[model samples]
Target: MSKRRQPSPSHPTTHHGDPERSFEPYKKAVILGLRWSNDDLDLVKPQAALLETFRIQCGFETASLVIPSTSSEEALNAISQTILELRQKYDMDRECTCHMATLFVIHYIGHGVSETEWEFDICGTRRPDAVRIPWSSIYIGMKSDVLILIDTSYSGNFLQPCHSLQRILQNNDHHAEYLFSTGNEISDQNGPTYDKNNNFTTRLTDLLYSVSPTPVTVAQLHEALCTQANDPSTKLRYTPQYMDCYKPSIIIQHVEKNDYIWKIENTTRKAQIPTGRALISVCILGNTVHGQVKEWQASLSTMDSDVTIEGVFNLQGYSLCLLSMPISLWNSFLHPGYNS
Candidate 1:
């Protein structure tokens, strides 16, 4: 028998509205997951997860400014403008409706200013704070609804004046949502649970795959984050905060819960595609199942067992067969996969 292709696990997705509905929210989104500050600060897992989530789960066309690599001020500014401009381009390119479903997300996986005042990444010999860009400057330019996720460990004191989401949104006319990694004290957000990234992002990525399997709204995400923060099962707690959102109900796309996941690679290296082959585990009955995929596809069944799976194989390996529609329909009789 040949080696079974084992993709990564099944990630989560959210439904901003009903996926079955006529009109959907968050069709267009712009995301910037950067390690663009100091050389000592390079974030891996969170950035990778965010990129994939928005593309596969959120289902929004995305533009990633930089990952792990440092970005110049000019480049950062261009990215900010690109956010507003991308929406215009998305609507113009597609002849959808009078209004297009769009969302803007600014997710920082690395450092934010100091352990005190809030700030983003930086470069050059200038003082860290000098090169740092205030949160207000960049986010203020946002054209559409926005969600900001700060996975870095910074003091909550800097945010004292703007403690509540209601206060944060009250000052900014455009709706904004905020989620921080910790409340105050020292944060354990930097722990490595995935390959190179921290524990929080890896957990978050899995949460999207498990919590909601369709386009999700900001409120739904907040709930899931809160559960994880206070989850008894988890030793690592992350504080999730949000309020006064213009459309907390607006959709944010992500990975599906039931996907026959096929990870593009197998490596654990940061900023590189895996070994470029998907891996999925399976159990074959006999040689009879090998003659044609259809046979294995047909003989699929299930048994009750205690197992934790990143992605489930209902009828054995499933993504390849489903990739080509004719095979999918030809094997429509195949059983469905499940999550543990």
Candidate 2:
């Protein structure tokens, strides 16, 4: 966790640490997907889906649901319940040998305001000022790290989202880190191009699910997010910021090697494949090349095809090994049928 600064003209997407597939430090994780009520906040569902996919791939077995919280009451209740659960888990872990930290994730998607201050636009009727959730209450009582992935422009600073978030974290007490998209408010006036998430939501999920079975670290995730933000074609107003509340890369997720197995098997592929791997999609974590690196991994999966894979992997025959057993079911698993 470092202080905020403008990203360099050229920051390589390659990571420089050795991370494992298992989300070690954090033994348990809870993803609370806040489905923002505003129609313009479509990024909510996909944001939740990315984390839900990451946790499951990281070998975590939890019964948490990733559905959007419709009303403010539902949102607050979900937040309360999540914090309480983390507190209990933290207390219980204290008594155990493997006193691992718990990862509390909150995916907030909707019309968020940071112009005069920071808050989420729940509904247009009272959108800008009505429903404001204090930052402290968001993770109160929890004794572990909190990772909040907000899909909103100007999350901390309405016009200067990064700077606002920086000042807030400078005086924050909780152990947390946030990944926010830097852009203008989403309204009828020059709103975000949600159509082809090839640059945003798509990259987000791909970055996490890149190396399945192999753990993906927070640092690595941050690097990928930054890479996308820095790219000019995305038309992002500000460089996406990855600010931490004094924590480390703890949460990790692993998906699969072939047949594009993962992230709500039925999850739709709204973006075109960015690699040359034919219909098969592979996410390269760490370095973009095949080399002997400690933090190297790739999570491969197909988006719209249900083809049978009859391949034999031999570690002796190749540098990378395939551990698709865990996600073998996901290889051909069906996405929970949706009406989209």
Candidate 3:
């Protein structure tokens, strides 16, 4: 797909104040799974299937293509053609009242080079048979939202070093650009076994399924993957990194959940909308006493009135608090013993 220039800002779409109506804009979803060899294709196939199923369930007309061979120029051409057809089919170029209802999900599992030279080589060599395509060559224009999951050696190279969270929050028509990767370098791939179930895609798919029945955003998915990576049992080598600029946030999966309350009835829980913003998780080491947890939450909230405790959960013998704080306090908050 040819890279196009950014378009002028369009009118803000009105969603009629209905939360569910926000997701109704998406009409079509295209999933492209790229792999190097037949062995990798076998794995990519199932992963693509899982993604396709999720997209379909989200009420979008979905199409999936598992393109094999890192060396085949034909494969690249196929991807380009598919993107072209998608643009035409969705009338992505036309400036309508709403953003284009097209979601592009790409999964690339192969060997990648540095960030500047963001190219994938079949055998990591510049041989005649090996096809090396730069990431810039791929169509990542501003027509639709894009989610790229890369499991390459230097997959983290795809990420932008810094992002503007405020821009994402303010811009209503801003289509998302999300990149989730294994790690930046080979050393980031730690641990022993990197088998079928232990690889990045496997762990990703697991979280995708586990978070079902609860609509999950890219930020939530990345946080879940990081939790899995820290766990020794999951066998996930590298911690995944996410780089996104999504307005109103992008929900990758949508599943219906019954609204039921138990003993905590008539009580309202602050809905933590994961906007893929600046959220930090803090762990407090201690018992599970309600008073103690409340004290910690109070102290943190007192320090910065703007700070919002997104979620609180216990894990690995410690209580964790997911906090949304102003960027100004990030330096002090990130330092060790700052709370103490």
Candidate 4:
């Protein structure tokens, strides 16, 4: 029998130096087209095609589509099932090692009514009356990394108050998400108009096809749409006010990050500490070793550092804390010190 060597008192035992994982290539996307009138199918078809182009450009391994021409219930059910199935198949805990991200795009091209309450006729059936597709339902079952696009009138209803697209984009979670819409809370009675030769759909189709070779960010796409909307000669009435209402709603519960975790303490009030105070202790853990740990105490009002951690030592009165440590060493002290 071999005895396990104990880790040094100053150093914890663990592995480190693993490169940060990426969540891009493994993304999955689904585009749902609801209630596109027969007159607008010509418009809808191209949008669907554009989505496929995005699917390919983004390298999404799996893609699905749902369109309801007449029955809203059937369409909602199909979309819901597709979401559920995809979530289960590529969930984080699944045995498969593949990283899974998802994008859901819902486009409702039809009439919207807000007299009694917010409602839209998606494929001839009223949404709230015939088949309700709440924001919660549509976004349910989603893990950390997901993007949602809602191209419809009154799409702002899907987003909760105070949540903005900028904030969503700024989120540091590895699995960040986004949501966008084609218009604001108001509905356009005339709907989208077609051009003499290429309608709104065809133009969008052409743009998407041409832009496929060069991958563009969501902001770029929005800029393109805005430019098209602002073209004075163009008959198309798609305005930024109409298509840019959808913002990002970050569900903090689903944030994904590396092993390093952060917690804000005494955030309401600032901590007062004297200058040049010595740190009590320092600790680190991870696979890779030999990295130096650094710490600094900020001045009461200025951004200058009053104290810092350099050599190993034990001091009194001042706060003792770990700034940064190897992942392996950090995990050792995570649990109550125990023997195996």
The most accurate candidate by lDDT is 3
Residue 42 local lDDT, model 3: 41
Poorly placed runs, candidate 2 (over 4 Å): 1-16, 20-25, 37-40, 61-78, 85-99, 115-130, 155-163, 186-201, 233-238, 251-340
lDDT ranking, high to low: 3, 2, 1, 4
lDDT of 1: 0.43
The candidate, 1 or 4, that scores higher on lDDT is 1
What's the TM-score of every candidate structure? 0.51, 0.54, 0.56, 0.43
How well is each residue in 161-208 modelled by candidate 4, as lDDT tens digits? Answer: 223323222222223233233333333486434232334344544555
lDDT of 2 by residue, 53-133 (tens): 755665343334332335556566766776576566645234211235556666655444444433333331224444544
Q: Is candidate 3 or candidate 4 better by TM-score?
A: 3
* lDDT tens digits by residue: candidate 3, 183-207: 3332334533334445677666665
- In the order shown, the candidates' Cα RMSDs to the true structure are 17.4, 15.8, 11.8, 18.3
Task: Give the least accurate 10-residue stretch of model 3, judged by summed lDDT.
Answer: 261-270
CA lDDT for candidate 4: 0.35
**Range of the 10 consecutive residues with the lowest summed lDDT in candidate 2:** 269-278
RMSD of 3: 11.8
lDDT of 1 by residue, 195-276 (tens): 2243556666766666344444454555565555555566554444444242323444443323643222212212111111
Candidates, ranked, TM-score: 3, 2, 1, 4
For model 4, what is the alpha-carbon lDDT of residue 37? 41
- lDDT for 309 in candidate 1 is 26
Question: lDDT (0-100) at residue 192 of candidate 2?
Answer: 53
Those runs of model 4 whose alpha carbons end farther than 4 Å from true positions after fitting are 1-44, 61-75, 92-111, 116-139, 153-204, 241-340
